[model samples]
Target: MELTFLGTGAGRPSRLRNVTSAALKLPAPSLSVWLFDAGEGTQHRLLQTPIKLNRIDRIFITHLHGDHVFGLPGLLSTRAYDGGVGPVTIYGPAGLQQMVECLFQLSGTYIGYDIQYVEAVEGVIFDDGNYRVEAAALEHRIPCFGYRVIESPRPGRLDAGKLKEAGVPFGPLYGKLKAGEDITLPDGREIKSSDVTGACIPGRIVTILGDTKPCANAVRLAEHADLLVHEATFAAGLEEKAELYGHSTTVQAAEAAKRAGARKLVMTHFSSRYELEDAVQLVDEARAIFPQTEAAFDGAVFDIPCQC
Candidate 1:
């Protein structure tokens, strides 16, 4: 799994950064990409890279802010034009469905693929055999949500040596034994898979939050996450302004990661006032509290290493 930051700026676009948008690509567990937020110009950013719009299976909108969702209609339209054949699911707060429909209806636009809208609330919004996604309400000025994507734990590797020692020959029965099933050998002895298999390998957990101030929900969702993607819309000393604007400062985001015991902190949504050269200071401030902290810019791609 990897994350590509399409836009990492706050409030508006700037020469150095664009608005907030990110792509989480899963090549193993799933052969598709999920977009965190489709801010304005996100499609254009994707155009620069090899990530095709037709491969995006889902788009999660954080809030109704123009910077977060202004490009939704355009992206959806482009996906259809780019040969997106399957249904595309979108999860967001209320009014998301209305906004998409209104734009297409007013413009007399038609799409070839089906669009499924799920109104995000504080609970598990999606669950498949591969992963489970939970949403928590955040402390933004409007109703915003944070998502926790947890990949399902995998079975332990098959122990061929142990199986061989137990007189289980290399045959179709080996598949059943690896699946934790009991099998009778040619000698009429039952062999249990627990005797040969190791412990299950845990999956990865990624927490991505919408624009919000320092809140308990953020910590709850990010608890022990492999990667926590939070917003730092201002420098450390600008806490007052950041709070007033429903945003978080560098230290505050780091503190949230620290409290949550997150393994890594990738901060984004930086204020346009700060230049790329200022990223070191911002990262230094966050690292003072959480050593694994890093600042992300447009086109920054983070490959989440396997824990097992």
Candidate 2:
């Protein structure tokens, strides 16, 4: 799995960065993209990358702020025009359906695919056997949410050599062994799966939060996350202003990652006042607290390695 930052600037677009949006690309057998937000010019950003609009199967909106959602209409319209006939599911807070429908009505836009809207609420929002997403209320001026994506653990690899040594031939039996099932040979010899399998591999955890100040929910959602993508809207010394605007400073974002025991952090949603070079200093401030912190910019990709 991997995450790509589409736009990292906060509030508005600048020469250095666009607005807020990110793409979480999952691996097969579900090779699809899930968007965290669709800020202004998001569809344009996707055009710059290899990701196709048709592969975007899910969109999770954190809030209704213009900077965070102004591009939704354009993206949805273009997806149909680009021949995306598959269903698209959107998860967001209350009034999301009404807002999107209102825009479609006013624009006389008709989509070729179905749109499913799920109202944001605390607890598990989506589960498809392989992965599950949990949503929690965050501390933002608006009713924003933070999402924790947990991948299901995979079965351990089968010991082919061990099975061969035990007189088990390669075939469907190997498949059963890999699935943690015991089987008996045609000669009536029994084989235990545990004796020929390695330990189960643990799944990865990724936490992505919307704009918010340092809060308990942010830490809770990021607990033990392999990657925590949080907003650092200001420099270290701008704590007062950050809190006033319901945003987080560089240091605060690091503190939340450290407190949550996250393996690494990528801070985004930077204030437009900071230039491209200023991202280095902002990241340095966060590194002082959590050494694994990184500053996210447009097209930045963070890959999550498998435990195996």
Candidate 3:
């Protein structure tokens, strides 16, 4: 899985960064991509990446704020114009459907593709054979939600050379062996999957929270995640204003990642005051608490490696 941050700034778009949007590109099981938080000018940002707009099948909104969702209608309409035939399912909090309808109607923009809406609840919102999605409420100004994406574990590859050496023909028995089932060959030899297959690769877990202060639910959703994308809207020593604005400081976000036991932490939703020149201070503060921290910026891409 590859994560690309389209927008990483907070509140508004600056010359350095846009608003808040990210995309997860899945290569296996499905070739589709999932978007998180389509802030303003998100569609324009998509054009900058190699990801095709038609490959975007799901858009998970973290909140109803204008900075988080103002670009939805524009993106959807543009997708239709670009000949996207697949239906786009949008998952968001309440008033999302209403907000989308209002935008479509008010602007008189018509989209050719179908759009399905899934309201956010504090539980498993979507579960397919490949991935499971969970949501938890976060401490934010409005009804905001944090999303946890859990990828299913994949079976290890079968050793074709070993099987061929074992006098086993490439047939239905290979399927059984991959399923961890024991099978007897024509020579009455019992073969187990463990004898020929390597260890199974573990799946990945990613947690992405909206503009929020550190909370228990956020920690729970982020528990044992491979990557935790938390908002650091302010620098350190601004705890008072950070809490007042329902945002978290750099230390607070690092603390949340440490408490959750996540492997790595990437901080986004930075205040416009801090430019790229100020990244060292922001990264240093978070790294003081969590060593494995990356300060996310526009066009930042992180690749999650599959582990066995």
lDDT of model 2 at residue 300? Answer: 91
Model 1 per-residue lDDT tens digits across residues 1-308: 89999999988999889899999998663778999998899999998778988779888998999999998899998888866378899999999999999999999999998899999999999998788999999998999999999988776777888987888888888888766688898889999877878777788899999999999999999999999999999999999999899999999999999999999999999998899999999999999999999999999999887676
- Higher-TM-score candidate of 2 and 3: 2
Worst 10 residues of 3 by lDDT: 192-201
Runs of candidate 3 with Cα error greater than 4 angstroms are: 160-162, 171-195
- Return the lDDT, model 3, position 58: 94
How displaced is residue 196 in candidate 3, in Å? 3.0
Native-to-model Cα distance after best TM-score fit, residue 83 in candidate 2, in Å: 2.7
Which clashing pairs does model 2 show? none
Which segments of model 2 are wrong by more than 4 Å? 181-184, 189-192
TM-score per candidate? 0.94, 0.96, 0.94
Question: How well does candidate 3 score on lDDT at residue 52?
Answer: 88
**Residue-by-residue lDDT tens digits, candidate 2, 1-308:** 99999999999999889999999999887889999989999999998899999999999999999889999989999999977469999999999889999999998999999999999999999999889999999988999999999999877998878987999888899999887889999999899988899998898999999999999999999999999999999999999999899999999999999999999999999998999999899999999999999999999999998878
In candidate 3, what are the lDDT values of residues 129-196, reduced to their tens digit?
Answer: 78999999999889999999999877678998888878778889999988778899888999888887
lDDT per model vs. reference: 0.91, 0.94, 0.92
Ranking by TM-score: 2, 1, 3
